[model samples]
Target chain A: MNKRENERNPVETPAHDAAHDALAEELEALRDLFQKELDRAKNAPDDAALPVKDGAPDAPPDADEGPVCACCGAPLTDADADAPYCEECLTQMRTRPVHAAAALFVLAAFLLAAVGLYLFSDSAAQWRQLFSAQRAVQEHRLLDAADRYGDCFLMNADRDSVSLTGIKAYADLCRSLGDVDLAALLVDARFPGPLLKLPWNARYRALLKLQAQFAATEQVAIDIFGAYDDYTDAAVYEDVDAQLCALRTDDTYAPVAVEYIRYLLMKAAGKPAALQMQQLEQMEAVDDGCYTGYYLAAMIELAGETGGPDAARTYFQTAIERNGQDQNAYDAFVRVLRRQPAPDTAAIFSVAQAAQANAPARGKPVWLRLFAVSDLLRGDDAQALREMQLYMTACYEQQLSLTMEEWNLYALCAAAAGDEDACAQIETALGSAQLKLSPVIGRVRAGTWTAAEALRKDGGDIA
Target chain B: MNGIDRVIRVLTAPGVWIRSFWVHLLCRIWAVPVTETRLFQNKATFGHLQHMAPPTVGAAFAIGFVPALLNRLLALLLFLSSLLGLFLFRMTGWVALSANTLAFWFAFSLYVNTYPPAEHARRMQTMLRGQGTRAQKILLAPGTFCCAVGSFLERRGVTFLLACAGLAALVLWQGALFAAIARWLPNLEG
Candidate 1:
């Protein structure tokens, strides 16, 4: 088999040897030619003389060659034989005296034209109307302001920035006057069918439709939504609450009722936590899918404030059982657990495990981070380090950045796990400016520090 | 550079080149002698002009505004005429559409090239800080500031992108407006 293979692929056949010999001869010829050229170049004179054609020396042109331009070597026309430079060159060299007067006249003409065009422009009219509307509002001439604003909108309803500004101003004026019908009319006229087709205008169109719906019903709902800008006024909240209560039982208005309740909870000051919790529960009862995880989180918070951490934990546990997919419930549970005088690490770990199991692809990093934190709190440094690595890998997969606090936690875990290389890598990645817990990392590695103490020193909350 | 960078450079070259030509022309008219002119891959350069006197803010403003105002007027005319022909006249066919497209591209190129170069802006700034009268300064402040800012933004191609966005928005607005008018005209006749 070896003999047959060698016969099939001979290393040095006669044809190959012949081709090699031919290549070597060609290379030798080229080398000889190159050497000759090199010798000729070396033997050449300092200012190498031009090679003569047919062994003839250079000679001057006959006078019959005719005159040429002195500046450019182009043949001069007989009509301009005395001229030294070519026509083109002459024109280039010729400098016309500054036409100062003509230039100033032209400048004046352009400036006047610009000013004239601007003064009579549609944009100018729009600007004037906008200014008048603003001045009218300042002077308390609501009627004039509305008219001017309407004119501005009609003139430029297709202009996003200008039309939006005018519409917003008109809406504000109408709302201040408690004229829902007029506000609805303003939005409808400004945002016609074609304008509403634009993607950016969809929200405005929805708002207009919502206002129309509410206007068809009790105008009080519109008033409650639009007129309660002053949060400090007890009278405003009382009025809003009264209107919301009246609409609470109507299924058509339940979403509005829920929104106003959430708004009041967020904006209303000095309201008792128990009352807030009561309102939240009422909102949830009538929510009709309008209830978000945020409301549950708020309820948990209020429960913790009014009924202590145990109550909050119960509420969070109930929320998780009701909707395990709700990340907010897990967050609230972890928060409430961590706030205890002595946190139950086992419970925290279990909640984190449940959260990780239920988390969507986007939320996995957050849950993994929570798991790492729980392990760190449990004093299982190596386990925490492993969890942190997993968390970072998850974050990388999701293209999410680790917060400064998370970086600090990772460094702490690395130090406490006695992984010097990992600690050094973290320090290099974070830089000294961002690694606020650098001093504490060393102490934690020395077994004289804790993650909670490092967090405290770095002005980060343990929770 | 990468493909997108090369494409952008190619796209922006004409505007810069035209602006350089205008600058050189304006310098000559102002009695500054331009010794030579040279064109490059993306920009043009003119030989240094002999300044008889320090450039005044007013002169700088006029130099910047003349070509810019002319170009803006031409662009606006082209834009409005195209809109009218397409919507009101109901021009159809590839011939009309191609004409309108060419007009639109030309108008866009002219608009992009309207801003003065950075040298004019620097001259304006120096004169504004040094020797201009308060009334003169006040009168010229808004125009000069806009020129300076436009110059800066143009170099980074931000102005070109903004102009493109504005044109897109304008086309959409005009389309919507014409559609609404067409829909309403029939109802009113009925």
Candidate 2:
């Protein structure tokens, strides 16, 4: 810490001394490795010496000289050999190129090979093609998709087969095209493998047109008959008929499906009553009864020909047994009873009352309104008021439109029941409309919608 | 060992086989001159100096002989194109001549990369005052010149003959350097 010490060489300081000690340790380690190298050299063969200035391989050894290499403990090879290392030690110590550079070269070569494989391999190309084809399908690029798909299939077909996904995609393509010929061809190529679970029967009726009889499968028959809706054009009648004929032999069609098929055929061909009855009997003999209120309503066409209201009553009972929620069946049965020569007034009233109690909040039976309105028409003021109150309350809760006429009927029912308060609520909602005798709601469309065109045109003004 | 000792160990670790070289350079204590170093090392032994002279001569001869051998080998590999102009008196003789010229020029560049070691060795030796004997130069100069020639011949299409010639000379140069090392470098290591 004094000036004298400060002026001295830094190497003598504590820190420098520690560094020197570390350096000595490093040298000692290096020397150990050098010693090993020399020992290895000495064990090789008899030592050879270069002819020195003395011109004598057997020159007299210097008395003061000792071993040159510390480890070998052998005599020095030359007169002034001051090197601590022997020949082998020097060989081992030769500097080598940086290993990181060499390793980088190797890694680069490996990546180059990987990139080459991806670029040039057939499988990689096929994978890319398949990917492009899928992209094209998503973008609705049908031509590009077809081209890429064709290339992909051809690429694989030469050696293997299209994967299950590829086959499924082809099936999907056929379905999307919806051309009978194309569907048949592609479906035949794909089959039960891809279609085994995917709307099998619907797709079959659509794509399996080769035999026309494919429609006959109970599944296909169901799909064909059920195919008609406001959203889709009806399936071909010939296809439906062929499938129906086929379904007669197949036992898979449930009774409801057969009844639906008969209903469709009756509507399609305007078949005789006897033919429909025969079909209904055949349907009734099939799968456990699946007839619902919809089916019973369809059966209402045969009502006058069969056992009259009794037959419809039986159908309604069967429908209730099959699907207890068929309020439409309940409504239809009440209608049939009310239409009878000597109407079962109590039965109709009770059926209407029971339907009101049974109706769910959403999709309540369409005929519940029918029964209430029919009761009103029959002048059973108390029962009509009760049923109509239940129906109108539901209409309000369900956000269903109650055509202007329906509101007036509700108001009339309330008046008949002497529920001035209920009539007041309706009048208030209508903004003081005095047209309580309006016949706007004389009939309703099975309660599918409550709003009639006039109410919409009148901007929902019940008045 | 302090830091100085560590540095000394590293500098000396390659084994100062020719320790006298350092003393001659740094201590201003010169070894026998290039000519007399070998002679004076065994000046007392009459026959010892005699033995050294022959190897130097042999090394020079071998150095010269190597290039000649390489030249002939190249001649042979040249598809005997070099001989075509010598014998064929055809009107198209100039064509083969031109081709031989182009081939030699192109093939010479193959040695451009191989010349640096000889040039570096010579430069280092002169810088360190450890110049070897004439025999070393005899070995080094031809390869360096051939590499120069080869580099100039770039884009002429490789002449396998000249390339082989340069490589052979390079090998000869290495051999000569080794001989000179044993003879003169004994006292030059720093």
Would you list the C-alpha lDDT of every candidate in the order shown? 0.59, 0.43
Q: Which 10 consecutive positions of candidate 1 chain B have the poorest summed lDDT? A: B45-54
Residue B87 in model 2: lDDT: 19
**Which runs in model 2 stand beyond 4 Å of their true positions?**
A1-259, A272-274, A289-297, A300-305, A357-371, A380-390, A399-463, B1-190
Off by over 4 Å in 1: A1-120, A139-141, A150-164, A192-203, A215-251, A254-463, B1-18, B24-190
Model 2 chain A worst lDDT run, 10 consecutive residues: A3-12
TM-score per candidate for chain A alone: 0.38, 0.34
Give per-model TM-scores.
Answer: 0.32, 0.26
TM-score of chain A of 1: 0.38
Q: Candidates' DockQ values? A: 0.02, 0.01
The residue-by-residue lDDT of candidate 2 on A396-441, one tens digit each, is 7777876675676577566655667876787778766444434433
